[model samples]
Target: GFAGNTIPIVAGSALLALRALEEDTKANGKITITRGDNPWVDKIYTLMDKVDEFIPTPERDTDKSFLMAIEDVFSITGRGTVATGRVERGSVKVGETIELVGLGNTRTTTVTGLEMFQKTLDESVAGDNVGVLLRGVQKTDIERGMVIAKPGTITPHTKFESQVYVLKKEEGGRHTPFFCGYQPQFYVRTT
Candidate 1:
């Protein structure tokens, strides 16, 4: 079940990333950002550039988005979970089944298993990244920035609201201020 544990942690962390994307939507409505220091992870940061500065938290707060990182997954004999997540804001614990969605879509699955640092647990709360095990999902179905929630809480977003900032260099940042008449390419989490 190593795959099962690793998949959820990876998928769960990806979902958290989407929440950050939503936050960027609120600030500038549209924005353009360069990749981060990490090439693979930073690539996703570039995608947020089309959105605005303001980002929406999972709580729908207008505050800045929190960061979630996938550290690594380890296997323990007789244990049924993998370690994942680098908490940037809140703490994550065990025994909680969170919503697990995919990038580019909103449909989601549930995280049926979880664990903390090393102790076996049923769920993981917030803060601090944790390892986890999943039930009823496959490996290939997940990607970076997938959306995860606390059951029945993950909502589908076909067309939602956001803040977008135009790339300063793209249009010389000389467009009329407060103007809202453009539709740039959009990228978000999907089932």
Candidate 2:
């Protein structure tokens, strides 16, 4: 009972804060709040409606090319190498060709199969979490943080720029600066 009321309120507040940050940054996306039936549901619903009023729908890329962010890579005895992740854009069909782009290299491969929840699928579209069986690639050649996309649609970047937001400063003392070549373990899309 304690959590039922407090959790929704806290989560709703956090979402509202994030929405405000998005507005400050002029970001393009809507935040929709979904929750179970609870005492605070009405407040969350009101907040959701208020946020949705100002947030605009994200623009969809017109390109028909497909892309998936690789989350796991493994090999099956009869299936060769399989890469699993959500299809981030477009659609990929069972027999289509795609390229694995990452780690300063790219490998073109054919989609031998696609499966979700152990059932085979003829095609997988955006937002679908599917395991793709690839031909002519070994398990060692693929890894997490790689992007699977239609050939020629994506190119590996040698260097890129990004903005970092430090959520919390160290409690004890001043924060140390990270110099060039400081490698941190990177996690992307649950990988």
Candidate 3:
């Protein structure tokens, strides 16, 4: 369930979650559901083969290709810059070189370290939220809405086409009509 104002966004996220669970179950032959006090806990538990017992391992591709959606950026005392985000595809490891793509430019940088929940990790795979310290890049060079990816794997683009639903018009009386060339601040991932 979602709040009143976030129904559409939550629905899309729920759909994706269900799809991922289905894929995991099919690949692993079993699924585990953690019990909680939430109303839907029992419903989810009933759909699984085990409760708090089965651990599904996700396959990680470490073929030198990866992508991360930047959620936050900060600077450390000794480290140059750090970007935190979930790995969207492939895997990244310490010492690997990557390209930062955003803000109408691309900069190449190396991964100096990786951390999650205040603990350092040698690598991070898809679906793992982690912070990566980067070398040769300043904090001002990165920002939210940027993407970090393996060098030569992605090309940054300024124009994109997407379908948007106008909620105001669907609620009740007519609002200001939107026309072509209308621009709005778009939020993606955690940005």
TM-score of each: 0.37, 0.61, 0.64
List the global CA lDDT of all models: 0.46, 0.77, 0.79
Name model 2 segments beyond 4 Å from true.
1-64, 170-181, 184-191
User: Per-residue lDDT for 59-128 in model 2, tens only?
Assistant: 5442568989999998999769999998877999998988989885788889999999999999888878
Encode model 1's per-residue lDDT on 35-148: one tens digit a residue.
Answer: 552343454554454233334444422132332333444444554434366434433334444555434554334444555656666534455355555444444444445444
Displacement of the residue 137 alpha carbon in candidate 1, Å: 1.3
Tens-digit per-residue lDDT, 89-137, candidate 3: 8898899999999786898889999999999999898888899999988
Steric clash pairs (candidate 3): none
C-alpha lDDT of residue 103 in model 2: 82
Q: Best by TM-score, which number?
A: 3
**On a 0 to 1 TM-score scale, where does candidate 2 land against the true structure?**
0.61
Cα misplacement distance, residue 39 of candidate 1 (Å): 43
Candidate No. with top lDDT = 3
Candidate 1 local Cα displacement, residue 87, angstroms: 6.4
